[model samples]
Target: MLIRLGYEIAIDCPQPMPVISLLDVHKDRQHDIKRQTKVLTSPFTACDVYEDSFGNSCRRYMAPQGGFQILYDALVEDSGEAEPCNPLAGETPVEALPPETIVFLLGSRYCETDHLSDLAWRLFGHVPPGWARVQAICDYVNNRLSFGYGYARATRTAAQAHEERVGVCRDFAHLAITLCRCMNIPARYVNGYLGDIGVPPDPAPMDFNAWFEAFLDGRWYTFDARHNVPRIGRVVVARGRDATDVPLLHSFGPHKLTTFKVWTYEQESYPVRPPARGIDRTLTTPLIG
Candidate 1:
């Protein structure tokens, strides 16, 4: 199957601002891309692309004072299969696990495993280990938190989210990742495009999506506490210990965000002519305080 996906974002700065973005297709998916446009910006800001420690492609550039915009679109090749469900995938012992995966088993900025450890143990101690245990965690989180855009708190931590019982997809991912770590499972945060395919269309505006991956059976497997069901067309952009590590945009100076938009869907075929760029267009708005 072919999937079309991309994002358009516009921001304004009073003066020059250095920023980094993780909006490009992940390096692992380079082979899966049929064709894509280069990351493009309005007013043409020079950019340098680099791979972060987590292996996510990072685009860096300086936004000139006034209005700055970014746009990127792509057609990706997918197998047309939902995420795999493996109930028999057993958890790897801490000592026997990969050295790199150990980082995910510890605490992080948003995923406070230390604070959630006792609760996780008390709630899932006897739920049977391995994939079943992770599913149990997802089920609990899916039922525990109320979903909505209003509950999206950038500073919200896993413990805080569990107490509030309200949050967006990142919170669901944070809580689930923390609980998994407390139970000695390596889990990491992921953000990317998840179009509403093979499901009812959503009336709300589209935006980038958040989910997570847990190390099980010597490999990482996808899981989503927010949806708690297998989903199709998951195009990953970045992975980190938590949202802190891979925020879509990290600006060194303050800036006003004027627009943010995203799109993804099943594409029957490619565009007649591939566009020569990337990022948000039609952002002629003047900068404001």
Candidate 2:
């Protein structure tokens, strides 16, 4: 499968200000499973952009701007390719996990103790003493949660979503991460895009996707509780201990958000040629605030 994605971000600040920086992770990786054909980042104003690879070796772009009317856009094409399974599931132990796994366990601070432990038990009950525990948890989350557009606020936690019995992608991811952490499995929050899931395109609308990553056997594995399956066109932007660590965008001053919108779509054809040269590879350091 081939996918073309377009993303637009606009910020309308309450007052005119100076200095704005953003980290973008849209460059498709050149690996076995997928190929990035083309990627273009457009800013409304003049800005400096840099590229760097972070913890997972994913490419990221950074831009710094001045004043208001901050707009960022990117276009990317990715081909559906399968990657080799890490196979960490067979050798690593639950107690002795990787760094990524450890971080995930410590990041989720709001998951209910009993609920999370129950999930961990479900995943670990059948596992050999020293193996990765992500697949079971992923399956459980996918089976347990129902995908819906509106169930709670964007900032709601896994415990809240579980009590309410409804949640969007982010909520589901959070719930899964919380459970993984509770189980001593490492899991983190991921913000990015999932191409149009048979939805009609609407002008001036917003469509962003959220998922989670579990640290298992020896590496970070991507899991989508909402989709239950993973494939290409799944671009990861920012990842953190929780939602607070990887917000889509943050403002320093008191800026009333007047409007926000996102849209994702797929093209009918695949790329006929390879990617172009001279693609910017500058890394942008994220500012937590």
Candidate 3:
């Protein structure tokens, strides 16, 4: 299916700010199941912007601003061409796992004690098959937690979310990632947009959204335990070991915030490109700190 995605983010600071930086991973990948037809990025004013690729081979863009507005737009075409089934079905389970996936499972900070991993294993014992394990964990998280604002800040961790049993999309994604990793399944945090299903159109944008992706069988599959539904309208900005790696916005120095908004919509009937193969081996220049 072809999709047109638009994303806008605004920050109203009490005072004119000194510096603003953005790390955007909004570009879609040409992979076994999806393709990128057209992509574009433009800032509202004069700013230094550069492109790079991260360890996972995802493309990234960095832009800087000061007490201002930032707009990002991308027109991508994704075909739902399915890839080969994950090869983990019959091989010795240990041999089927990827090295990166294993690292995420064992090395992520979220998998520490008293987190989702501990609770999930205590309740479910051993993980079932790939699909079954994901489904079971999804159901557990959805039933155990309630979605509400004011529970915690954006920086809250998976351990905090597990202790409180309440949080927004980010917390849910973090918890899910930790649980999947504990089961020896590779999972990562995703940042992006999810348009309101009921609200009328506002020229301004909406709030950012978060979800988790799991390496199942042999490929990454999207899951949103926060909504307890399959992925849609998930225009990914970045993917990382956790939320700390893919923040939608990061700022330094003190500045008062007046208002912020995000807007997104889907365009129908765009052109779709064929999937590209082979590892993406390009190196990324060090980001401006």
Candidate 4:
């Protein structure tokens, strides 16, 4: 199936500010692009594109005072299959896990594994380790937290979410990720385009979505605690230890989000074409704020 996805966002700045954006589709999905992903800026400036440490495509440029608008659109192919489910997938012992995967097992900005370690063992210690253990953590998060747009808080950590029992999708991901890390299951936060494709259209406005992935049986698998069901047409943009590492945009100076819109839906007649040349796949040190 073909899915059309992209966004139009604008920010108002009081002065020139250095900004980095993680709005492009992930490096892993570049081959699925049927239509080239093109990014345009209003009051155009030369935007330098690069790859971040996590392998996410990033754009960096100096934002001039006033409005900074960004636009991009693309047609990408999807398998039209629900996220894979493997209840029997086994977890590798911590000592046997790959060295690179060890970082995900540690606590990060939004997911404080240290604070939740005791509770995680208390609530999930009895569950059989491996896929069952991960599912149990998801089940607990799905039940404990109430999803509400109004409850969204950027600074909410996993422990706080567990205490308040309310937050947006990122909170669901953070809490699940933290619990998984505490259980020795490597997990990371992911944000992407998850539209209502094989389901009823939502009444609320569309926005970028958040989910998570867990390393199991030598590979990572996707999981969504907020929905707690297999979903289709997930076009991932970025992944990191938590939301702090993968926010859509980060600026050196204050900026107000003046416009935010995202779209991801089936495009029945999207044409497929060969990839263009000069697409760099290497990571570059970005001008960090």
Candidate 5:
């Protein structure tokens, strides 16, 4: 299946500002792109692309005062398969886990392992270490919190989500990631375009989504605490210890978001199509802005 996806975000700044955006389709999925992802900026500025320490592609540029817009649209081919699952995938011992994967096991800005460690152990220590345990954690989070876009909080941590029992998708991911770390399973936060394909369509505006991946059987596996079901067409945008490491946009100066939009949907074959262009339809350089 072909997945058409992209976003348009506008920010207003009072002075020149440095900004980092992680909106590019992840490197792992770059090979599947049938149409190049393009990032167009209004009142354009030159942008340099580089991969971060965590391996996420980032765009750095200086934005001038006034309103600035970032836009991208592309079509990517997907296998139309749901996230893979292995019931018997076992967890690797900390001593045996890859050195690079160690950081994911520690606490991070949004995932507070120290605060939820006790509860995590008390709730899941008895369960076998592996996929099943991670599923249990997702089950707890899915039932514990009520999903609501209105309940979204940018600063809420996993412990807070557990106590509040209400939050958006990121809250669910943070809580699940924290619990996985507390259990000695290396898990990392993930954000991307997850569309309502092969399922009933959601009657809401499309937006970027967050989920997570836990290292199991020596590899990472995707898991979504919000839906608690394997999904298809997850075009990953970035991954890190927690949300802080992969914010969609970070500006050094004060700014106000004037516009935000996202899209992701499966396309029927033989009709070769491209995503509809934004109002400011001018395309930019390097194919990836």
Candidate 6:
């Protein structure tokens, strides 16, 4: 199936500011793109594109003072399959984990493995380790926290989200990732396009989604503590220790968001979308302008 994905975001700043954006699809999905518009901006500025440490495609450009806007549109092919479930994928012992996967087992900016280590054992020690344990964490998080756009907090950490028991999708990912790491599992944060492809349409305006991956049985497998069920049309753009590493946009200066909008759907279901919004504005450099 073909899916249309894009976003338009506008912000206001007091002065010109340098910003980096991770709006491009991940390199792994580059071959899946059927067509795309180069990331475009209002009041065009010079832009440099490069790969970040985690291999995520990144765009760097300076935003002019006042209102600035950035937009991207693309059509990508998908298998139209739901999230894969493999309860048989057993957890890898820490000593046997790949070097790269080791980083995911430690704490990061939003995921605090140290803070949640003891709690993780107390809550999950009895569960059979491996895929089932990961699913249990997802089940716990999905039921513990109330999800809503109003619960978003840019600075919230996994420990804080656990205590508050209220958060947006990122919080769910953070809390889940933290618990996985504490249990000696390699779990990393993921953010990307998740269209309402095989499910009913979401009435709320679309936004990039947050989830996580656990390295088990020699590979990283997708898991969403927020949804707690298999989902389809997940298009990954970046992965890292937490939201801090994969911020859709990071600005060097303060800015005020005046408008934001996002859209993702099967090509045939594309709507008449408004033209103001940006990708993952929930975590930044904030957004353009």
Off by over 4 Å in 4: 271-289
lDDT of 2: 0.55
**Model 3 clashing residue pairs (backbone):** 12-258, 14-256, 86-217, 86-218, 205-262, 205-263, 206-262, 206-263
Over 215-257, each residue of candidate 3 has an lDDT whose tens digit, in order, gives: 7656677788888755444556677787666655555445544
Q: Estimate, for each residue in 1-289, the C-alpha lDDT of model 6 and write its tens digit.
A: 8787778878898999998888888999989987666677887888999888888988998999988988777778888899788999998888888898888988899988888999999999999999999999999999999999999999999999999999999999999999999999999999999988877888887899999999889988999998888998899999989999999889999999887777777775323453234433442212212
Model 6 spans with C-alpha error above 4 angstroms: 269-289
Candidate lDDT scores, in order, read 0.89, 0.55, 0.56, 0.88, 0.89, 0.87
Q: Estimate each model's TM-score.
A: 0.95, 0.67, 0.69, 0.93, 0.94, 0.92
Q: Which stretch of 10 consecutive residues in model 3 shows the poorest summed lDDT? A: 280-289
Q: Please give the TM-score that candidate 3 achieves against the real structure.
A: 0.69
Q: Model 1 misses residue 180 by how many Å?
A: 0.1
Q: Candidate 6, 123: how far from true, in Å? A: 1.1
Identify the runs in model 5 with alpha carbons over 4 angstroms from their true place.
270-289
TM-score of 5: 0.94
Ranking 5 against 6 by lDDT, winner: 5
* Model 5 poorest ten-residue lDDT run: 280-289
Using TM-score, give the best candidate's number: 1
Model 5 C-alpha lDDT per residue in residues 85-146, reported as the tens digit of each score: 89999999999999999999999998888999999999999998898999999999999999
Better of 1 and 6 by TM-score: 1
Q: Candidate 6 has what TM-score?
A: 0.92
